[model samples]
Target: MAVKSKSVASKIVLTALVLVAIFPIFWVFLNSFKQLVDIVSTTPKFIFTPTLDNYIYVLGRDNVQHGLFNSIIIAGLSVLIGAVLGIPAAYAVARYPNRFSDDIQFFVLSLRFLPPVAVAIPLIAIWLDLGLYDTRTALVITYTLLTMSTIIWLAIPAFSRVPREIEEAAIVDGYGPYAVFFKVALPVAAKSLIGAVIFSFILVWNEFLIALMLTTSDAKTLPIIASEFTLLGRNVPWGILNASVIVLSLPPLIFVGVMSGFINSALKKKD
Candidate 1:
């Protein structure tokens, strides 16, 4: 009877915690249906007619659709570049585990500590001088700079999870080092790679400062578009602004859900 009571108490606490975490998302969803006037009104109107005008307003904008496409391309390429560079570095670090690997790891993490404005000043000037400003390439390169190290960091522990003896046994069977990596290590660490790709994509997609400085028109992204929500002369379309943000952010939220599934499956393996 005591144990049953404890279990029920625990369930209640867990349910409460879950509700608390989800309340903010519920609030945003409700607010998305509200007009700007209703949104600003002090009294909460829980049961009102839902409208789609905010969505229409957002979709009617000139470059919002195009900017979403640009955001996807830039984020996709960043994840690709990060994966290409990060995996090899992680493999070497896992396989080598020496001073050179340690130094490189430190250098990569150090990039995170530097303030954004400090880096942007020189980066923008350099890109402008080279005629690379306002281009997709600038975003890709900057994102790679920001995201690759994180992938490597995530991948290293997963790589280490593979038994060294298993790799040596592959080597003894006449497979080359590269073959062992592709055939042996990669399969074991597949979940981590997926996690890294999702994380890197999210990082580049939400990147604001560098995208603001480097790209103006040809490669503007959703973050840049979201910044233009307020018109100086007109009252801010708070409803449409929030709706655009909600829509623009949906893809990343979906990615995170998919990642959660991967994590669940990976944990099921228990190896």
Candidate 2:
């Protein structure tokens, strides 16, 4: 009876947490289908005629498309760059556990806690001096700092989880370090690496502060573009804004669904 009660309690907690996480997103989705009048009504209306005008207007804008394209490019490239650099660095730190490695790990982890404004303030000055401000390249570089730090830190545990014996055996079999990493260590740690990639992609996709400061027009992202709906005039276009939010959120949702198995598997495995 106690066990059953505990199980029920756990389920209730999980359900509540899920609802809390999903409610805002569901509200925004509902707003997206509503008319401007319906959205801004004094009281929330559960029953209302849905329309496609909000979506139509949001999608027809060239800035929306441009911002989305930039978001995709920036997030995708940031994750790619993060993976390329982080995987090797993580492997090194895991392989060599010493003072130097400890220092590197501390530095990498420290980046995660650093405030965005702290990094963004100096980055703006440096970017301006280098003539890279307001460019995709600048955003890409700035976002790499965000994604790469996360990748390197998260990937450490994944690499550490890989058995050293397997790597040693591969080396004895005449496989080079590169081959062992690609064939043996990587395969063993692929689940965690995939998790890192997924997380990094989401973080980069939703990042706004640096993009807002650095990008004026050319490199503006979906979040930046969505935010502009509020800044257009005194009255916020809630319907159009919600439509943009829904559109912007779809890719991350789809990516997570596609990678759910990997994420679940990684979570189940001991680190």
Q: Tens digits of per-residue lDDT for model 2 on 1-271?
A: 9999999999999999999999889999998999989988999887899999999999999999999899999999989998999888998888877779888988998888888988888988999999999899998988898888899988988898888899999999999989998999999998778888888899999888889888888889999999888886788888998999899889889876646875676567564
**Candidate 1, 72-184: lDDT as tens digits:** 88988888989998988888898987878878778878888989888887999999999999888888888888779788877886788787889999999999989999998
lDDT scores of the candidates, listed in order: 0.83, 0.89
Residue pairs of candidate 2 with colliding backbone atoms: none
Minimal lDDT window, size 10, model 2: 262-271
* Cα-based TM-score, every candidate: 0.86, 0.87
Name model 2 segments beyond 4 Å from true.
1-18, 255-271
Q: What is the lDDT of candidate 1?
A: 0.83
Sequence-dependent TM-score of model 1: 0.86
